[model samples]
Target: MTPRDLLRSAGRNTFRRPLRAFLTIVAIAIGAFTFTVTSGLGTGINTYIDSQTRAVGASRTVQVTGTSVMSFLNERMEVYRDDMDTARGMDVGSGILGEEDLQRITSALGPDDEYSANRQVSALYYSHDGGQRYRFVYNGYWPGKTANLVAGDQLRDDTDQAQLIVPSYATRPLGFASAQDAVGRTVEIGVLGQDGEVRTVPGTVVGVQEKSLIGGNLPFGNQVLDDALQDASWAGSAEDDAQWYSSVLVTGEDPDRISRDVAAQGYATATAEQTVGDYKSIVNGILLLLNLLAGVAIVAAMFGIVNTLMMSIQERTRQIGMFRALGMGRRRVFSSVALEAALLGVIGSVVAVALGVLAGRLLGPMALDLAGLDLPGLELFAFDATSLVAIVLGVTVAALVAALPPALRAARMDPMDALRENR
Candidate 1:
């Protein structure tokens, strides 16, 4: 028989036992549905991570934090008294990155490399029109990296001018009509001093930052503005110690080499790519576990395929003998049975892919809304062509393999024996 003829015959034979074939197809569909949806979830999350990594300037930049030896010790009594005494004796400059360390880092860099130091600020208070003050946390904005801005512009690192970037969500609370309206306006920021006094400083609102999963609550400012606030808090207090930075941001052409070099200087470094990679690994691991559970359903479906094919073979013993008595070869008979199994797989996969894609698109947003996560520019479902093709091929292969034993038994049967036994 021609391949086309064999395919036509196989398809007709598959549905001879309609209930059994339908049940087997349903079983395979369950597996395909699980795999496709889980893969979509992984793709969506990784895509979001990629976008966030770029938003935070992670592509060309690395965050460096001073390696503190005391952090390695536990807070319990297991920490020796001598260790505690030594930690106490270490100055603020010793434990964190100081001026000397910053200078060393800069000197080691090439002319193309740029760096920004993050200064710590405390007890920041802000108000619009000099009324109804609100306290907020602060984070130093690195001018070397691009900010994900919703309005206005990034803060200038070169200027000592008091400029601030307000969070997008804070615009309405700060009495602005919108994020754009908040830009080019003056807002008063006050630092609570050690002597119970609030020293107010007026800063121009140069930009408004979009809400982010990371660093959403805190407002950002340039080095000059951060320094002014820190200095104000330190004035009139015995805490007039040398300035120590919280962390440093560095940008270089070769991030791997820079990370190693930063580590050699007794500081820890994290790149944006590395951070995203770590998050992807975690997301992939969870998806893998869920896929495995779905695999269980596919395996059960395989057994169903095997049983259905075996029963069909038994009921068609005389028909098979008649075909062999004709010009039909054993290989053709095997091919026919295998093609039937493959057809069932194709049907199941088509149904599954349609359902899975629809579910992923609809349920993703609903899940996010239920969780109350207001992450802007996040898509929870993303589908790719490669993944869909893979799902179909995988399920088809599994179904064909399960039909193998039954096909072999039918193919090897003697025509006279099969006829006599059936009679």
Candidate 2:
């Protein structure tokens, strides 16, 4: 028989026992839906993390921070921890980086390399619109990468006036109705100065960003703001300047070699890849477990496909014998059975992927609301063309594999015996 004729026959046979085929398809769809959603979540998170990492640091960035008090190597460098986040940044066990310390840290680097300092700073209180002042924290690490702007513009390098980017979640708490409202507002920042007192400094809110894991509740400051805060910080004080320094950042193509060289100079280093990967690993671990559970569903669906096709073959014994008697080749018979199973899989996967994407668009925001999170631009169900196509192809291939036994049985039928069996 021709391929088109065989395909038509398979399509026609797939629904001979409509209810059975329907049930099998349902089972496959369930698994496909779960797989689509889980994979999408992982993809979305990884994409976001990668973009953020690029903005915060380069592939070859090596962070040169203060000495690690936790290190038993006689305080060589700041201890690196995967779990360390912005919330626990200041409390991390590390000695101060002195001015000489910055020089010492950079001196170990190749002359072609340059560095940026992430001096730590705090804002005791912020006030706008004459409301109650709320406390906040600011960091000096500047990616000048893509800014997650909901409103206004990213901090301009051309200007040095203290400019801050507030997170979207903090708009209401900071006396703003919306992200747009928060922009361009002059606010008071209380920075602790060298003389041991909090000084109210004026700054403009240039932009607002999405709430992020890496940054936590922290707002970002431009270079001028960072320097001003650093001037008030412990490491920035002239009296302690010679004895302490903050985190210094620089880029080198070969981080392993760069880190090794720095270690010889009595310093420790953290690459941007390592720091970002730790966070990605945490995300990946959870997604892996979720995907595994989805895999279980798919495996169960395979059994459903086998059972459905076997029953179909048994019901069609006489029909199979008649087709064999009609001079149909064994390969054609096998192809027909296989195509029926593949049709079921194609329908299931297509339906599942379509519904999954729809659910993501409709219910994604509801999930965030239910969880009491205000993370803007966070999509729980992101999908791409490649992955969607892969899901369909994978399910179809799995269906064919599962139906192999039934197809072989149908192909090997003895015309006279099968014709007489169901008589």
Candidate 3:
């Protein structure tokens, strides 16, 4: 028989036992469905992580902090009590970067390198239209980091006045209809003094950003605002001794090399890509376990394929003999059985992918809601085309391989002996 005829016969033979074929297809579909959903979950989480990492300037920059002499001791108790007492009275910025350390980091940069200092803001308070007020922790840094802007413009370095960038999540809570409405509005931030006093500082709303995965509840400000808040917070305290920075942000053409150099200078360095890589590794590890569980289901389905094809071969012994008697080659007979198995696999995989995608779309938001996470622009389940293709091809190949033994047995049947068997 021609190849086309053989394929047509194989396709028809797949459903010869309708009930058995249906059960086998369902088994395979179970595996495909699990794999697709789990893979999509991993992809969604990693995509969110990558976006947040980029937003925090992790990719092209490294955070540098001064190394402490406490590292020389094996245990915290090993430090002298006198030293602990001294540390209690020291400023919050003690052991962090100072003017000399900042200069050293700046001098180590290449001609194209840029650096900025981050300072801790004591507290941030916001009120609107004489409504109830709210307070939270805030951080100050240079503007120019790419962010998911919802309205207005990013804080510019040239801006001399204090400005604030609110997160979209705070829009309604802060009494704004939308992010656009929040822009250009004046807001009061209560900067806490070292003596536990709340001092109000005026700041103009320049922009609003979507809530970030990594940044959490901490709001951001420009250097101008940060410096102003720092000065105000230090008022009535010892502000003239020496200024210390929380951390130094360094960006260059070669972030990895810069990180290493910064580490060599007795500073702890954290690169954005490193943090993202660690998160990716964790996500991949979890997905691997999930995929393996799905693989177990698929493997069970493969055994079903083997059993179904073997039974079919036994029942069709006479038919095989008749086909051989008609001068069909052994290889063609083998191809026909293998093709039948592949057809079943294709049907199962197609239906499974459709159902899986539908389920993912439906369940993604529900899962997020159940978990109590209100992340904006994050879909808990997202399909990747490459992953879908791989899953289909892999399952089909597995089914074909499972049919090999049955195909071989049919191919080796003698024409005269098989024709004599009872039908």
Candidate 4:
């Protein structure tokens, strides 16, 4: 028979036992869909992580603060089993990485090395509309990046104390709806400075950023870009408030190599890739467990296909004997059974993929509610080209595996005995 005829025969036989075919298809679809969705989530996670790493503009970053006088690290180490545990119990003290220490670290670096320091402080925003408050605000501060500079100039070292670069959120009360319009205007920055004084500083907006990153060690909330020079001024003014040096950023193509070399210079380093990888691993582990559970549904469906095929073989004993007497090879008989299984797999995969795409679209908007996070660009289910290819491969593999035993049994039937018994 021609290949087209064989295919037609396969399709016809697949539905001979409709329930069994349906079950087999369901199994294949479940397996394929799980594989596709898990892989897609992993990809999205890694992409999101890398974007965060780039936002920091550093392959490696180190945070060195003053060692506390009370020997908290030592006390924690004595009480805890490991460095990680000790870190959890410890709090930073002065002299770890002050201006003088930063200068010293910079001096120690090779001529090729360059670094920048950032000041980190937490404060609550007082957003009031005639005594009606919407929400309390938390945000981060950054230096700048070449990618996201939408308007005006980036935070420069020579900026006066009165100038600031506020995040887009800061402009809500001022009647500006967009980040672009917020730049070049003035905003209020409130904080309890060093000493027992509460201070609110007014500064000019220098720039606006397009992307809002919320991953890695970079930042946890909305962010504003500020000049490094201004950071020093804030720290100096609020000495008692103690704005810690968040990071000393270092850049190089290969962060692992750069971090190791930097460590030898008496300064610690953490590669952005390494940090991001750790975060991805945590997310991947969760997805794996969830996908595995989804896969169980597919396994149950496969049993239905097997039962259907076995019944078909029994009912067609007389037909099988006739085909054998007509000189059809055992291999052809096996091919017929296997082809049916394959067709079922193909149909199931197609249906599942279409379903997955629809699910992603419907669930994308609910990402915020499900995840308890307002991820700006998140989709609950994403149907990507790579995922589609993976689904097809998974379905094909399942079909071949499920077909092998049944095909062999059907091919090995005793033709003469089957014909006599049928009569």
Candidate 5:
């Protein structure tokens, strides 16, 4: 038979038993659907990290932190893990960050590198225009810091006016009409000092920032504002020693080299890229595990396809003998069965890809909204055309592989034996 005629015959034979064909296809689709969704999740997250926040790691900045050596965290777990790595064996106080250690951290950097200590601020409650108090989360600004702003500018190191940048979500809750309106508003922060009294610090909102898939939604503040908050954090405490800083930010032309140099000084350092890489690794690992599960399902479905084909061959033994008697080649018989299996793969995978893309578009935004935060530019399940195409091809090849045993059995049958099998 011609290839076209063979294909047409295979297509018809594939659905001769509709229920069996459908069951086999459904099994394949179960696996393909899982793979499609997981693959899209990985693609979406990696894309966001690369496009929107790659600067976080690529900007040549290293975050340096001193390890904590003591903690009695039988109750206060959050306290022990807020800023430092509290996982260490018993030591006589591993001591606070001494001036000598601080000096080493700064001197280890190249001449062109800039250093800025982080002022750790504890929990804060802020109010606007005498309104109700709301929880405040913020990070101090450094020279390498960036903000994707909807209005105004990023925190300037040159400014001493205690600048603040709020995310768009904070605009309405903080009593502002719009993102532009949120700018230039005074925000009053009420913090509980170490001495057990409330200290209020004020900062001016100079910018409104955009929300990102990877970037933290915490507000950004200049050093001036951080200094004020730090003062509030330490109010009424003894002035017997200089303030201890657990972490610092270092910016330079080469952060990896600086990280190594600083590590030599008994301090741990992570470049922004390394931090992002760690996060990416976790995401990829989880997706890989999910993909493996899907692969197992696909394998199970392959077996199902094989069973379905074997049954079809059993029912058509005399038909095969007739085809061979009519001068059909063994290769064409094998191709016919294999093509039937490929047809199953095509139908199953196409259905999976269609549903996966639909779920990504329809459900992705609804999920984002249900999260109770506005993630304007996030694509939770971004489907790539290349990935979809690859999935279809992989499944088709897998189906063909599954057909091998059945196709071989049919092709190797002697014409007389096949014809007499009915008797």
Candidate 6:
């Protein structure tokens, strides 16, 4: 038979067994719908984690901390192509990175690589002015240190003058509306220098800054927590010698590997990849459980399809015998059955896609409400081309899987036998 004729026959056969066709199609639709929704949610979660990690500057940072000597070369470098025998451990505390180490690491990195080094001293600050003391955590810096900035400029390179730049919103308490307002103003900071001296540095507000979503926050400082003391220019400097920093920031391809190598050099590295992975793992684990439950609902639906198809076969036995008696091939009969199943799959998938998109739009706002923060620029669901392809493939596979047994059973029927059964 011609392909068009086969399709026409399939359509007629489907309607002739209305209850069976309805049940099978509904099963396919349920499976397709569940798959689309779950997959979309998975992609959304991954995107959300990426955004948060990137927001905090996770990928480009490899947080370096004191490690046991044995931590060095803990595992063999089997994955690396480089010769490790000639590589020596670089000690961070020894100040080997002052200038030369920076050049070497930068040179060793591919042409695309760029890096910045900083002695990150975590400290607390509060508005010294009696106006309203706000406590905040900030990354202390030496004058002119390069921390990636999002809004304002970095501290000047040539001066010993201390300077500070904060997020755009940081200026609200400083009697300013934004980073532009805080710029050029003086801000008081409580910090400890390398000499273990506690002192407050009344630094000029140089610039505001933003970092990339794939990189992280500024290297020198971040938005202070609510409890960190907020100090204004009127507040006199206070010093504490307890805080110390042992970290450097780098960005490029294989940032995580570079961080591992930096740890080999003895300086602590902080990269965003580790942070993003941790975030993804946590979210994926939770979502995976939810998806599993959704899968159960779909599996139940597939069994319903099986029952519907079985009934369809029995009802069409006489028709099958007539076709076979007329010299129609068993394979031709099988094709008709399979095509019907596939068409149902396609219809279900199309409907599910539409429904999933609608659901995602509605659900995203609710999810954000639960998160308790407004994500102004963030989309509720982040599905890309890959996700779209996956949905189509998944639906098609489900249809074929459901069709196989039924199609085979129909094809195996004998003309006389099927006719007798119809009686």
Best-fitting candidate, scored by TM-score: 1
Clashing pairs in 5: 57-273
Q: Worst lDDT window (10 residues) for model 6?
A: 225-234
**Which lDDT tens digits does candidate 5 get at residues 276-333?**
7766898899999999998999999999999999999988888888888788889999
Q: What's model 6's overall lDDT?
A: 0.57
lDDT rank order: 5, 3, 1, 2, 6, 4
lDDT of 1 by residue, 85-135 (tens): 212222243145667779877776668877877654454689889767888
Where model 5 places Cα greater than 4 Å from the true spot, the runs are 49-58, 68-96, 119-124, 129-135, 190-200, 211-214, 228-243, 264-266, 370-373
- For model 3, the superposed segments whose C-alpha errors exceed 4 Å read 51-54, 66-95, 98-107, 124-131, 175-178, 194-198, 236-243, 264-267, 365-373, 416-420
lDDT of each: 0.77, 0.74, 0.77, 0.55, 0.78, 0.57
Candidate 4 matches the true fold with a TM-score of 0.72
Candidate 2, run of 10 with poorest lDDT: 80-89
Question: Tens digit of lDDT per residue, candidate 4, span 336-412?
Answer: 88787778777887788777666666665676477675444444455568668767766666676677777788898
Instruction: Estimate candidate 4's RMSD in Å.
Output: 6.6
List candidate 4 segments past 4 Å from native.
Answer: 39-53, 56-110, 117-164, 173-181, 190-201, 208-246, 263-268, 366-375
Instruction: Indicate the residue-level lDDT of 95 in model 2.
Output: 49
TM-score ranking from best to worst? 1, 3, 5, 2, 4, 6
Model 1 residue runs over 4 Å out of place are: 67-95, 99-111, 158-160, 192-198, 215-217, 233-243
For candidate 1, the TM-score is 0.84
Error of 2 at 151 (Å): 4.3
- Give me the displacement of residue 234 in model 1, in angstroms: 4.5
- Model 3 C-alpha lDDT per residue in residues 1-423, reported as the tens digit of each score: 777898889988888999999999999999988988888898889889877875665377777766432233322222233323312222233245567778888877788888877644565576666666788666457335656787888777687888778888887888888989999987777877656677877778888888767653455777777777876676655535455566788878788989888778767677877766766787899999999999999999999999999999888888888889888889988999999889888898878988998999998999889988888878888899999988899999989998899999888987985757854
Cα lDDT, model 3, residue 218:
55
**Candidate 3: what lDDT?**
0.77
